[model samples]
Target: MDRRQFLELSGAAGGTLLLGSSAAAEATPAVATTNHPKPVGAVTYYTEIRVPPPEKAAVLAKMDELIALMQGKAGYLSLSFKQTIGESTMGRAYPNPKKAILAEALATLDGTLSSPKVPYFYVMFLRFDNYDNLLASGVQAWFKANIVPSLFAYNAATTPPTKTSIALDFHEGVYTTVAAADRVNGYMTAEEISTYLASKQSDEVAGQYVSVNNHYMIMDVNREAHYNLLRENLNGNTRSIFRPIPGDAGYDDSDPDYVANGQPAAADNTFFRKAVTREILQNAFPEGEKRNYLMHGVWETIMDHENSHLDPRFSAGASQVGSYFIAHPVEPFYITLKQDRFIKSA
Candidate 1:
C-alpha cells in the first residue's frame, strides 16, 4: 500500500484506540520540563571532496584505505561515501552531453550557486559518539598526515607543496532525532512516550529504526521545548524523537540485498516514505514551479539510477536523470517546523 493509505488506516486506528480525553489531556504539556537530563548526542563530520578528472581513481583508492583504517578507531559509529553527480561533476562525466529535464527543474527552484564550478567526486559522512570523542578519534590527524599528501602528489614534480591543490570542505554538527516510526500502531501509551523521550536523550536508538526500515529524522535542534511540543502533538503511530546522527546516515555498509544474492532488495529504499503534505514538500522546494521537484528530481532520479544498475531493460525509459545531477548537484538544507506556528500560519 502507498504511504498515505497506510498512514490513514494507521492514524484512524490510533485515534480510536489512543485519543481518549484523558490521554489527549495528558499528551499536551503545559510547560516544557527542564528536569529531564540531556542525552549524549552524536557528532557528524561531513566532507565534500573534489578530485581532478585524471586523479579520481587514485583519490578514491586512498579514501577506501582511510575508511578501512577508521574502522578500528574508538567511538566510530559509521562512515559512508556518495559520489556527487550534478552540474559540478557533469563535464567530467560527459564532455558534451545533452542537458537533463531535471536540470531545468533544479534551475527553476533556486538560482543561488546555480552554476557551481568545483567538480566534487564524493561526499563523505563520518559519525562518532560525541564532539569530545570525535576530537580524540585521531581521524583529522590521520587525514592530514596520510590522505592529504597523496591528494596533492599528482603535481609533485612541478608544483610547490603549498601550490598543490587539495579541494575539500568540512562541516560538523550533532544529530537530533526528529521522527521515529515503527510498523506497529496504537501501541504507545502516554507513559511510554514520556519514558521513550527521556531515554532517547542518552540512548542509541537510531540504529533500531534502521534495522526495521523505520523512519528516523535527525536535526541540529537542541531546545527541549521544541521536542516537548512534538511529543505533545505526535500522531499515535508516529513518535518524533531526536537522534545523534546525520539525517542521511546509514546503519551498515553491507549491501541491503546481500541475503537475496544481489536481486533488487525489497528493503533498499523503504526507510523513509515520500512526504504526503504540501507544507512539507514546500519546505524543501519553496518555488511554486518546483512543487513536485522531489518526486521528479530526487525520487525518480534515484529510481532511474537503481534500475540502470539492477534492471537494465533495454526498452525502458533510460532517462539519465542521475547524469543531469552531475552539473546541478542538489544542495542540502534543513527544515524546522514549529507546530503552533505552523498551525497559526496555515
Candidate 2:
C-alpha cells in the first residue's frame, strides 16, 4: 500500500482514459462513454542494465540462446536484464543479487520497443500503436540486429543509447491480489504484494489500467524474528514517496535517503515489496494465447534494498535528485506521489 497508495488506485494523471476529444469524449467526467472505440492503451515501461562483471558467462549463454531463438515472437512483451549485483547469470537463485528482472509480456501492435532508458546497459520496452509503430517494428532491427550483437559479445559492452520517455496508455489496469503478514515481519511476494496493491489501489478504487480483481491476505510474515519488517516500513512515513509521477520514466531507483544523511533526489531503494521477477519466455504461457494472462502472475517483483532517513528534506536534496528528474519534463505528476519530497523511509 505504498507508491502513493499505488497511485491512489491507479488514476489521476493529466490525461488518458483514451478520450482525446469529441467534446471530451462526451463531456469527459471520467468514464462510461460506450459506443465502441476505446480499448487501446497499456504501454508501460521501466529500464536499466549493466552487465560487465566479466561478461557474466557470455551474457548468460547469449541470453539463453536469444530467449530460445525467439520463442513465439510477434510483439514480445516483458523483458528484463537489470544488472548491478555483478550482472548475474542466475546464481544465488537471484537473492540479494543486486537486480535482474527480464520481463516479456506483449499484446502485439507489431514490433519496435527499445529503450525504456538504456542507462548502464540493458533497458528494453516496445509498446507500439503510435510513433509509426515506434518505427515499423523491427524495433530498431531487434536492437541493432538482435539485441546489439548479443550485448557486446561477452566482455560486456553496449552503452550508447539514450531515451527520455514515450508513454501513451491513457489507462490500463490489472489488480488481483493476496497478502498477509504486515505487522512487519518482512516478506512480500504475491507478485510483490500485488505490485504493492497496484501501487496503492491506483486512482483509488477505480481508474487507469483497470482490470482483474481479487485480493485477500489478512496476515502472514511478521512474528518478530528479530524485527526488520522493512525497518518499520520506513518508520513513520508509513509508505514513502519523494517525487516521481509523470510517466514513471526509466527508474533504476536510488536515493531513498541513501542510508543515513545521504541520498534524497530520485530515491527508490528497492521497496515495492522487494522487486524480483524474471521470465521473458515469450509471454511465459498466456494460457494458449488470446490475451488471457496470469500464469502465477509471472515472476513476482520485489527487492528489499533498505535505506531510510526520516526527513531532513532527506539529505538535503540528495545529489540533485537525478538531475532534477531529468530536468523536470514540464512537471505534471498528476497524483503527486504523496506530495513529493523525494520519498523517505528513515
Candidate 3:
C-alpha cells in the first residue's frame, strides 16, 4: 500500500492537537523524495502513547492481549513495551529551552525527575522482517477493534461513549533500521541479528540487562545535506569517544584523556542503531518542512550514557548541526517492561 493508504488503515496523524483546541490542525510534511534508494532493511512501527495514571493498568492489560494476537502473524519478529524511567540529566549541561515555549512546557510537565502531573508516556516497538510485512501487520486493525473503545468508552449508555480517548496522545510512524553496530559484534545484518537472538536465552533475548536510550532531534526537510553530514560525522565522533577497542574489555584508564574525553571508568558496551524514515507531529518553531530523527542506543548502564556528554567533541558536533534543530533535543532512558521475539533457529 502507498503512504496514504497505510495512514488510512492506521489512524496515524501528522500533527498533535491541543487538549481541547478546535483550530485547524496543519502539518508541514517533508517533500516526497524522487529516485530514492529502495528500502531494504527491517522496518518497525514506533508508537508513543500517553496514559493517565488511572488508565495505566487497563492499557497494559490490552497490550498483553494484543501481543498474544501478534505472535502467530507472518514475518513478525518482536514487540517491545518500554516505560519511561527518566530523561538525560547530562543534557541539562547544554543550553536548553532553545525555544521559550519548550521551557514552559517542561516546567509544567516535568515528568523526568519527580512526580508527574501529566500523563505517563510509553513507547512501543513492533518489528517485522521487512517493509511489506510491517505494512500488512494488521496491528492497526486489532487496535481499532479492541483498544480504541477502551480509550473512548466511559459510559455504556451513550452512543459514542460520551468521552474521548483517555490517553492524551498517540504518535507513531514507520521507521527503518538503517544502521546498527556494536564493538564486538561489529555490524550485523538482519539475518545475523536473528541468529544472534536465537543463541541467547530468554532473559538476554528480552534485553533485561541493558537500558535503551532514545535521542530525539528535529531536522528541517530542506537541510537534508546538513542532516546527512551530521550523521556521517557524528558516527565517527561517537565511535571514537565512546566505543572501546574490539576484543578489549574496556578503555585504558591510564590514558589521561580517557576521563577528560568523558569515557567512563567502567567497560563500555553499547549497541547503536540509526533508524530512518520516521516523522513526528510538527510544530510552528521549525518554520518549514521538518522530520523527527531518533538515535537509538543500548547502553550497559544509564551512567555510561550520561557521562558521555562531558566530551567537548560532542558539544562541537552539536554546535555544527545546531541550526537543524527546531526544538531542544531530548534524550530519555527506558526500561523494557514486556517483550517477545520470534526467532528462527540458526
lDDT of each: 0.29, 0.23, 0.47
lDDT of 1 by residue, 129-223 (tens): 44456556776666555544433323434433132444332222223223322222211343332232222221112221110001111121322
CA error at residue 158 for candidate 1, angstroms? 11
lDDT ranking of the models: 3, 1, 2
Among all candidates shown, the one with the greatest lDDT? 3
Candidate 3 residues lying further than 4 Å off, grouped into runs, are 1-40, 94-118, 150-167, 185-227, 230-240, 243-288, 320-323
By TM-score: ranked, best first:
3, 1, 2
> In model 3, where is the ten-residue run with the lowest total lDDT?
17-26
- Candidate 3 local lDDT, 1-346, one digit each (tens): 2333223322223312111111122111112235233345556666665554445677788889878877767777777787665566555454322211221232233433223224555677677666566656787666555544444323334443244433343545555553343433322355644333222213422444334433334545544566455555445544455533334455555765543342442323332122111111221123234444555555545555554554465567656766665444555556667777556333
TM-score per candidate, in order? 0.36, 0.22, 0.61
Best by TM-score: 3
Question: Per-residue CA lDDT of candidate 2, range 250-326, in tens?
Answer: 34345443322122222244222211211110111111111111111111111121221223333333222212211
